[model samples]
Target: MVLGGSIAGLFAARVLADAYDEVQIVDRDTLIDVAGPRRSCPQGKHINGLLARGQQVMEEFYPGITNEIFADGVPTGDLCGNVRWYFNGVRIQQQEAGLTCVSASRPMLEKHIRRRTAALPNVVFVEQHDILGLATTPDKSKVTGARVQARGQKREKVIDADLVIDATGRGSRTPIWLQELGYGLVEEESKKVGLGYVTQHYRLKSDPYHGDLSINPVANATLPRGAIFTKTDGGRVELTAYGILGDHPPTDQQGFYDFVKTLAAPEIHEALMHAEPLDEPVAFRFPTTLRRHYEKLDRFPDGLLVVGDAVTCFNPVYAQGMTVSALSALTIRNHLHSGAAPQPMQYFQDLSKNVIDPPWEMTNTVDLSFPGVEGERPLQMRFAQKFLKLVQYAATKDKAIAAQYMRAAGLIDGPEKMQRPGFMLKVLLKGIFGPAKKTPAPPLVPIAGGHVETWSEYRNAA
Candidate 1:
């Protein structure tokens, strides 16, 4: 039994279906044939990126899924070569790295995955059900099933299962339930980011990307603001403007336009000047990145396991959540291949060491780079930040370095790949001798009835 029906829960159910006789997914929202975001998933209304590695993993699970998405009019491209990536206001040299990128909205992507999972013969979705808690054995050493109550009903019932997986996301009740069952508090680690973003949809009067899939102006210490302007399905464009360290984008129309005009990439602001607004801007706040140290627990009930954001929630700017959840599903698959229930500690240890550690450290390091964000910056972290800045500068002058950097960013490889002796020497040489040249911002054209003016000038005139 799975306690949620989001992406993580669906992935868990897909894998568990191969081992168990029947896999049931329980959630408060109606799960079948829904085409839009659920009430429970607020992040769905914003831009959601599926990194190159995530695309690979999803394709592996559901063969031809990429083509299927394309069939639905979603754009596809080479991860490094096709997208415009700017770091610290300088563009990374574009190169063909052969990594596949699928540009689909969160709702569209989840809808496809949910449809596939629902078709499995052994998988069933128990929609509109509230997960009450875990049903544990009298000794509190084993989990027997889950307690759930249907929506708009007072009666609660227990559903028996040989195994139970928690994919209930960051609001998981496992900790409190465990404490109630005689286990101590689950250790937790958190880093305050105070991140916020506002999103709106638009219809372009003219193409800004030419043939590219998306334009990303990544946030950095100096600028501290950024935006992702991407082409999605249904002939519409999605713009998600963001800021870090308590600097948030506004949801009002003029305020949101002002925020975009301030981004490092002026082309995005220029494009938006003539585009048709399809919807009002919406905002989402993420105050911190959280990790529950379930692996560190000395005692946990058997027949129970947690996956996805239930284990860790990274800063969303890195776009690691869905990819990490897919990787966790693969880990679950390996543990279940032995045809016996997985051991709790061993599974968690493997998950922590292999799946969660790399991205957790990467996001933390990047988040700490901003001076305003509060976190420990030991000597090692400081040194890493400096080196990464150098690498970003070098990536502007060298395509090889840029491709390698993209590999690491896509989660296909680890940061250690950039530590190769040849790679490090090249980066140093490029930093010392080959500084990036300044590229002038594109010229802005006047709209139908007005002369082009600076965003500040327009604001003052108003």
Candidate 2:
């Protein structure tokens, strides 16, 4: 049984279907029938795109899922090849690197994935069911299942199960439930980001961009404000303006425009000037990046596990949320493949090592790089940040640095790859000895092949 019927739950159910006879999902919200909007997911209104590795894993889990998303009219393109990125005030050069990523709205992606999961032979979605709490044994040695209330009812009932996984997201009540079972507090680590943003969808009067799916001017020291424009359905683009360290976007229409005009990248604001608002702006605040150390618990109930945002939640600006959830799902599949249920601690330890540690540490380092954000930074972090500054500078002159940085940022490769002998030589030499002249920017065009295809071409191909 899985708690919460969002992406995490759907994915957990997808893997559990192979090991368990029946995998049931319990969610409080009414499951929608189509790929549209939802009140529960405010983040859906913001920019959400798949990283290169996330796209590859999606294909592995649901083969041809990218093509399906393409047929639905979501934009698809190469990560480093098509997308434009400005980091620390220098625009990184583009390359024909074959890393593929998809820019799809959250609601659409979730809706399609939900449809597929609900169709699985052994999976069931229990919509509008309130998950009251976990059902444990008399001595609280194990979690037998969950207690739930049907929609529009006060009476609660217990649904027994061999395993219970909680993918309830940031609002998970597992800590309280565990304390009720006589367990110690789950340790938590957090960094206050004070990040906030406002997003709106608009249809451009003209396709001024040359088939590009996204353009981002990232937040930096001198300029703390940034914006990202992602291609969406109905010939519209979702543009989001964000600020850090309590510098938030305004809710009013005019104030929002004022914020965008102040961004380091002018394209988003320029396009918006001639665009038509398809929907009003929506605001969302992210207080901090948090991680619950469930794996450190000395005593945890058997037959229970926590995954997804329940374990940790990153700064959404990194776009690591859905990708990390997919990583956890893949880990779950690996642990359950032998068919004998593993201990909860073993599963959690493996999860922390494989899924949580790398990305969590990675994002934490980046967040600390901002002057306004507060955190403890050791020598390693300081050195990494300094080295990365040269890397961004070198990226403007060297295509290899630019492409490798893209791979690292996309989660397809580790950042350390850029530190390799060959790549590091380029950064160290060209970084210290500046280039004789400015390098010409790569042409704004998507790479050919299945690696990248315009939405118009995708429609015709389908």
Candidate 3:
């Protein structure tokens, strides 16, 4: 049994379908047939995209997912070649990292994965149910099932299972449930990131960047504003303006555009000027990033495990949440191949050390670079930032270094890949003697010959 119907939950259900006789999914919201956002998915309503590694896992779990999404009108491209990333106020060089990635509204993509998972004969979606807690053996040594209450019902029903997993995202109740079962408390690490964003959909009236699938200006300490503009289904675009350190993007129409005006790059703001608005600018707040150290617990219930954002929630701008969840799901598939009963402790340990730590450290390090966002910056981060700036500078002139850095950013390669002697020499020599081009923020100007569309001609016209 899986607790939640988010992408994490769906993936878990899909993988578990082969191992278990019947895979049941309990979700708080009603499932939908169409590809659109839902009331339960506040996170999906904003700007969201999958990283290269995420696309790999999703497609691996569901064969032909890439072609499936493309058929749905979601744009596909080379991970590094089609994306323009701005860090520390400078654009990263464009190069083909040879990684397949997709661009679509988060809601639309989730709907496709949900559709695939729901189609499995062994998988079933039990909608409009609240997960009360876990049902365990008398000694509380192992979880037997989950206690759930259907919406508008009084009595709780216990659905027995050989294994129970929680993919309920950042708001999961697993921690509380564990404590109630006499388990030692799991340590939680949280970074107070006062992040918020305003998002709206637009129809791309013009293509100025020459088929670039994505435009992004990341947040930095000097300038805490950022934005992402990308083509989704129906020849329409989604513009998400965001800020950290309590600099919330306003939701008013003009105020929303005003937020765009503050981004490090003018490309997104410029595109919005010529496009049409398909929806009102909506706002969402991400107050903090939380990571639960379930691996630290000495004793955990045998039949229970937590995965995805229920384990660690990253700042969405990095686009790590979905990908990290995918990694965890992959781990689940690997362990299940052993055909042993689920082992929560061993899974958590591997997940924490192999999957969660590196990305969590990288994200916190970048967030702390802002100075306004408070956190510890040990020597590793300090040293990494220096070398990274050098790499960023060198990447503008050297495609080799750019490709390596982009692959690392896409999670296809480890951080150690950038530290190779040959790569380091290239960056060092390029920084020493190269025709460096200065990439200042483009002056924000209106793109001519385009109109603002308040509504869409076709929702998924791809």
Task: Put down candidate 2 lDDT per residue, 1-462, tens digits, no spaces.
Answer: 999887877788888898999999988887758566665666877887667887888778887778888778788777777777777655677796778877788888887788778888888778788889999999999999999999899899999989999998998999999998899999999999889999998766544356566788788776777878877755567888899899999999999999998876666676677777888889999999999998899989999988888899898888888888888888888888788765888888998987888788878877888887888899999988777777877777778788988888888887668768988887988676543344333332322341222468533533
Give the alpha-carbon lDDT of every model: 0.87, 0.80, 0.81
Q: What TM-score does candidate 1 get on C-alpha atoms?
A: 0.95
TM-score-wise, the better of 1 and 3 is 1
For 77-112, candidate 1 gives per-residue lDDT tens digits of 777898888998898888989788877889999999
Candidate 3's C-alpha runs over 4 A off are 32-34, 432-435, 439-462
Instruction: Please provide, for model 3 over 1-462, each residue's C-alpha lDDT reduced to its tens digit, 9 standing for 90 to 100.
Output: 999888888888888998888999998898858566777788777878788888988988999988888887777677678777776566777888887878878887888899899889999888999999899999999899999999999999999989998998888888898889888887999988899998888765655355466788778777888888776766577788888889999999998888888776776776677677888999999989999999988889899988989999998888898898889988888789888866888899889988888788778777888777777788989988767767877877777787888788788898889889988888888755543555654444343345322112222221
Candidate 3 local lDDT, residue 455: 17
Q: Model 2 compared with the native: what TM-score? A: 0.93
lDDT for position 2 in model 3 = 93
Q: After best superposition, candidate 3 residue 308: deviation in angstroms?
A: 0.7
C-alpha TM-scores of all predictions: 0.95, 0.93, 0.93
Which parts of model 1 have CA positions greater than 4 angstroms off? 433-435, 441-462
